[model samples]
Target: MRSVNNHCDLYDFSIWGNEDVSSGKGAKDENFPVGSLLISRKLRPHVQAYYNFARVIDDIADSEMLSSEEKVKRLNGMQAVLCDDVPAPDRADVQAARYLRNSLLETGVSFDTATDLLIAFRQDAVKNRYETFAELLEYCRYSANPVGHYLLDLHKENADIRPAADALCTSLQILNHLQDCRADLIRLDRCYIPLDMLRAENVDVQAVKDEGTISGLRNVFDYILDYIDDLNREAEQLIRLTSNRRLRMESSVILTLACSLTEHLRKEDPLATRVKLNYKDAIKAVLYACPHILR
Candidate 1:
């Protein structure tokens, strides 16, 4: 098993695209999400590449200022470009786009799966609000769950564990959106707080965008908090279905981070402050995953 894992790790490494890492932002941003993966020197490289791809797409969607139609067009074209089915266009930002293209070739990640990722981001660019929780889950299925599913495919084990991982990843993503509600709303014009919940709270959609200081803001937060709690509980049940030590530790680390975020949110006003973890707490999470390194 060790030999097989080592070989897989090598293949994974070859697939990792060399990019500018001087900012150290990637490590810092994933402080909560992929702590367990970082703890192990043996985690697959392609897994890291996949993360980079997601990061690039998400950052482009969230941080950049492209027109909505242009953003969707570039994202929709990504699959063909990555697969060498299309030539590099002048409009695409070559550096980031090249990294994705090369990483796709090195990892043999299929165009279909890669397209799913792009489509998710494209949806993010234009689709600001979800109509229902079920609609949100479908969004999660596209945006968040694919990362976990793709990683499982790379490992060639834990196919059975994916349903649970799917749930957990979706929960984590939703948790992030909730935690960053004010930030996302103010900066990105995106709101994950469902429209139905807004109606229940009597918060006008324009009010959320303009003032964000309505009775409905607090009520919406409370309602979403309840949903996040329920998802975490379901995730806890799913984590028990996996026996793989690395996977368990990884899941535990994510759960702990989610729990920490959830707990912190519960104690403080998320609208008033951004919750952040210090390096010490991060080190502790990494250390907590140490015992499972061998698996």
Candidate 2:
């Protein structure tokens, strides 16, 4: 294994070439707010650093250009840089890891919160189907839960609030899965909907490729939405549990956004079109979160 400080030669790009597969998406493009105005200005840089690292790895995992082995290798390389097991290569993704490494050091947050995301992205490189909802939530434990944990840690919030934070993060992850169901199937051949649920609904996995959601798929969507509703309810506790005023407001807004998006997913056919919160929904989120800020 190469030492983290081994600054031998720059990493060779010939192995994968210098082509960038980044989706060119950033935090602002996400469905939920990220390091938004609600976050303290002092801490936004750390949040943005984390977001950039996550976005890079997600693109790597989702890339059609890379083979499964190559994707895993790349993700591992990024992780190596993050853990300071090896110096970052002259690449954007690895540089992202280095940036986040600095952020983790500055914030006194656990590096595990960042490393845990790699476990999920690595799984994404190889696993495409979920056997059950339990399996999917297990995936979220690594993929989504760390995000909330990072924020809570940054704000010096109580660890007891983690369950609510996990609930909210997992809810957002599933909502994204539902919204991108068709595109994921077509582009990456990945499916987040549990296989058991599809089997129970008598819906084939390929059904998502249809021009519109079939009745069976819609039923499955509704089932998932019902579960998300429960998660949103559970996540509601985060607002009260968070002692920091800004974090409380941020949690309240995110919970409201999750609930609004859940309702939109229930009514809209994702296969037919993407379901998203509108400006009115944003307004409502702010209105709902305002009381938390005042309190």
Candidate 3:
């Protein structure tokens, strides 16, 4: 609730704040996989701070070493920090919270977007599998939609863009879930693929662990691809609606990659192998997307 700029310093902290991520992975560079050059340099860090907040909380929620009770306590501590309800445990949490306070005072980033993300993270602490596709999507509204809303707020775009942006963000989340389905289950006991869909295809969770394949789940891959296509198509409206040239191009690049990956998923079994977009395709996506993006 309280603004952090004058009271707290963001520069003095990193996301880890002396705690090891063990993976040695640093903060989530909101600009990295996407590229800093695509957007203004000045704006990158401000938004990346939000990403750092997400990464830190995600670590707390996703860390395999911690007991569920510990993760929940740490996560609730974050909510308290955000609410100015309690003192931050580290300089990074304080700094990240400060950045959000400033964003609300300056660029119109919503408190709900910042806070609701925790709800999803908390859900991760307990919930394992989604019973239906619609259920998974409802989760995406909490987990993914906040991100799109925040981005729009950052760029000062029209509020109407939120729906389309939500679609784009949700598509990315679902795609990543499919790509990492094997790791998620084996590592965290979490499964993002809806159970009903898998059942309809005649597959079960054990089939996933025994082998990467969808455990005799016929049409599973196609079903996922079809959903990806639908979500991507719906998100195209957002790409076209984006007002800023840089943001528009950036969204286009993402959409291009999303489509290409969907095509690849169609050809390969996601349950069996992790599909990566090669460097060539990555560069091509930028080039192809740049045309309309620059317009």
Candidate 4:
């Protein structure tokens, strides 16, 4: 939330404050973070501050060494810091903690929303399987939707926007999970796709884990992609409801990218190959998405 004029500073704070996200390792998507930082600057300072805090705590939960219990402790400590019960902890995430305490002092966020995010990240620490799409949506209800709720609250948007924002956020989260399925399986030992869907498609998890190349993979991928397609269409309606042009543009572009990834994956089996957009392509994506981005 601090004025991070330098790209180096933004990247440093993002990485240092969020050492838990290994997904940044493969091919860095600087544009997304750059856009986020720019949007943070354009919006309220507390918006960016809270997001940074959320990201850092998420990273802590995702850390390989930290047990779920330890992650919960860190989150509880963060709550203590948030409530001003104690001095900030000594760690990379502490700057975020201190910033959050200050932000809370300035503009308060509901305790329920705050706790939901921590609980969601904690869910990531242990929960590895989703039994149904409904269950996965419940996960996003905590992990992704609260962000939109916070942002919407910042803008003083009415209850009408919550439904739209919630739908968009959950759609984006589901698309992200589908796109990262293979990597998530390898890295986190987690699968976001519901077990019910897998069973419906007659897919076997053990074979996919072992061979990583089975007909069942293709069928399951098809099923997942179809489900993502429906969410994407639903999210489009929400983009129109957002009053802020930049936020609309940001959300739209990201959703477009998700849709693009799904199309690409549908064209080629991800198990055989992973799809990545080069910098030039990503730049083009941002460019194409610019005109529609409301302010």
Clashes of each: 0, 2, 1, 1
Question: Where does model 4 exceed 4 Å of error?
Answer: 1-45, 108-112, 208-213, 279-295
lDDT for each residue of candidate 4 in 90-179, tens digit (9 for 90 to 100): 565666767766766666555455657877887887788899878998999999888778776665656587877777677667766755
Each candidate structure's TM-score, on Cα atoms with residue i matched to residue i, is: 0.77, 0.94, 0.86, 0.78
Choose 1 or 3, whichever is better by lDDT: 3
Off by over 4 Å in 2: 1-16
Over the full model, what C-alpha lDDT does candidate 3 score relative to the true structure? 0.72
- Residue 142 CA displacement from its true place in model 3, Å: 1.2
lDDT of 1 at 223: 68
Leading candidate by TM-score: 2
State in Å the error of residue 47, model 3.
1.4
Q: How far is 246's C-alpha from truth in model 4 (Å)?
A: 2.3
**lDDT tens digits, residue span 46-77, model 3:** 67777767777787778887767766656665
What C-alpha lDDT, on a 0 to 100 scale, does residue 71 get in candidate 3?
66
What local lDDT does model 3 show for residue 192?
86
TM-score of 3: 0.86
lDDT of each: 0.62, 0.88, 0.72, 0.65
